[model samples]
Target chain A: MKSRLRVLRAERGWSQADLAERIGVSRQAVNALETDKHDPSLGLAFRIAAVFDRAVEEIFDNPHRTEGPG
Target chain B: MNPFTTGPASREYQLATAGWFTLYGVILFTVAWAVDGRGLAAPWVYPAAVAPALPIAGFLWTVLRFMDRSDEYVRAVLGKTYVIAVHLTLLLCVAWGFLEVYAGFRHLALFWVFPVFWVAVAVTGRFIRTTR
Candidate 1:
């Protein structure tokens, strides 16, 4: 999943650590989300979206057209 | 406040994980010693090792029992670490079994493997947090 987490966090002048603390996850998880290397779970996605006061769809995007293998 | 011990109802989850750790350690030592010294078949060792699944199930049951309204960052991180370590440990142990049993190689010992895996998990988890 691709996410606008970094952009949203930056708009609020928050460091990755700051955002992570607010959302109750590690800074690396936030960094991974920003880099699109990891996809947050639904609960985490909701938490991130809540922190930015945006809908989950607005923050996260499915970059791939086809789903990968299980 | 430490949610693990004092905050809300999550202390039960913490205690359960600790209990699982104890069970895992005890079962591993007993099974390892029994299978190594005695005349038990190597295949029987598999069933003994699977005993840890009981504790793991108990731990997860506790986690589900007290799903708090607020997230616990520490628990989430530790839980992820535990999961990743378990996966890597299982993979390495299986690979070692195949190499030693099937291919006639017995280079790695259990003592070294256990400590290496424990340290690797800690180092990897810390690296994930500390890297700039």
Candidate 2:
């Protein structure tokens, strides 16, 4: 899944290591997440959201979601 | 500290693995000495031969504990590596067994399986790309 984690971290002026430390994950994990090589589990997603101070959707793109008719 | 491992759990796992291997080496040497140099009896040698397995069990326990303490991503990566390693080891063992039976190849010791599995793990881990 694609994520705006890199952009969000950049906006916050946080290096990958800084963000990884804040989220209690390794820098390599953070790199993998940002590169879309790894997807976060539900619990990890929530933790990432909490660390970013945003909803999970704001950081990770949900490819499964479809637009409903108005 | 293993390059693939990170965080506090990594340190713990490394220490545990070292301890287990150290114990394994000592037990193995002792058993060999008893069986060979000291001429241990048949009945006693059977139980003595199994002594090194205790440290192997400890190593396996350490692996399980490390998995429990690892984060989701590391666990996932390791899970994949193990799966691949298991399959590879099994395939090789089966093929070698056929060769031994049909082609009159020399019989391989069962203890070699553990080392073969570890070799497979090392090979697969290189390609699997775990977090450093």
Candidate 3:
């Protein structure tokens, strides 16, 4: 799963630590998420989206998983 | 009062960091006693032996306070490890009981139970945090 968290956070001029503190997680976790080293669970995704005031889908997208051919 | 409501990692890190202070005390005490050969005569020996335990207890309390808020995955991992520890403890206890019953062994050391429980919790916590 790839996410726009980095871009979103950057747009808001927020450092990873700032975002992590706002989201109630360790800064390392935020770094892991931004680097695609870790995938956020649904709850975490929702929280991230809430922090950005954006839809979860806008922040997260599963590119590798494709829909079946019609 | 509650570490979990504040921050889990922060509390864990704080307690672990403070544990080093107790470790220092233990090391200093051990060295003094070993070098002087005055373990009994040293008036500080008793306090030195027991002082570190106070910080250790505080560390344990902080860890427990935060651990109670572990996620489901954490809880499951810990629960599994604890189950294994419980089984191991039961096996040891039963073996001792059998020995006492049939082999006429008077008693078995009972101190291993604490290590068994400690190892289970320690390993489980490490596993959950580091697991991919």
Between candidates 1 and 3, name the one with more favorable lDDT.
1
Candidate 2's residue-wise lDDT over A1-70, tens digit each?
A: 8889999999999998899889888777888888787888898899999988989887888887776222
Question: TM-score for each prediction?
Answer: 0.44, 0.90, 0.46
**What are the DockQ scores of the candidates, in order?**
0.08, 0.39, 0.07
As for candidate 3, its clashing pairs are: none
What DockQ number belongs to candidate 2?
Answer: 0.39
| Runs with alpha carbons beyond 4 Å of true place in candidate 1 | A62-70, B1-113, B116-132
What ordering of candidates by lDDT runs from best to worst?
2, 1, 3
**lDDT score of residue A41 within candidate 2:** 85
> Residue B22 in candidate 1 has what lDDT?
88
Q: After superposition, how far is residue B90 of candidate 2 from its true place, in Å?
A: 1.0
> What would the per-residue lDDT of candidate 1 be over residues B1-132, giving only the tens digit for each residue?
222344445556667767877887888778768877675676877787676456656756766665443244445545566567767787888888899988998778665555556655655555442112
Chain B: TM-scores of all predictions? 0.48, 0.88, 0.44
Q: Write the per-residue lDDT of candidate 3 for residues A1-70, one digit (tens) a residue.
A: 6788899999999998799878866665676677665677789888888999988878888665486222
lDDT of each structure?
0.66, 0.83, 0.63
Question: Chain A only: TM-score of every candidate?
Answer: 0.85, 0.91, 0.86
Candidate 2 per-residue lDDT, tens place, B100-127, comes to 9999999998878877987898898778
**All candidates in order of DockQ, best leading:** 2, 1, 3
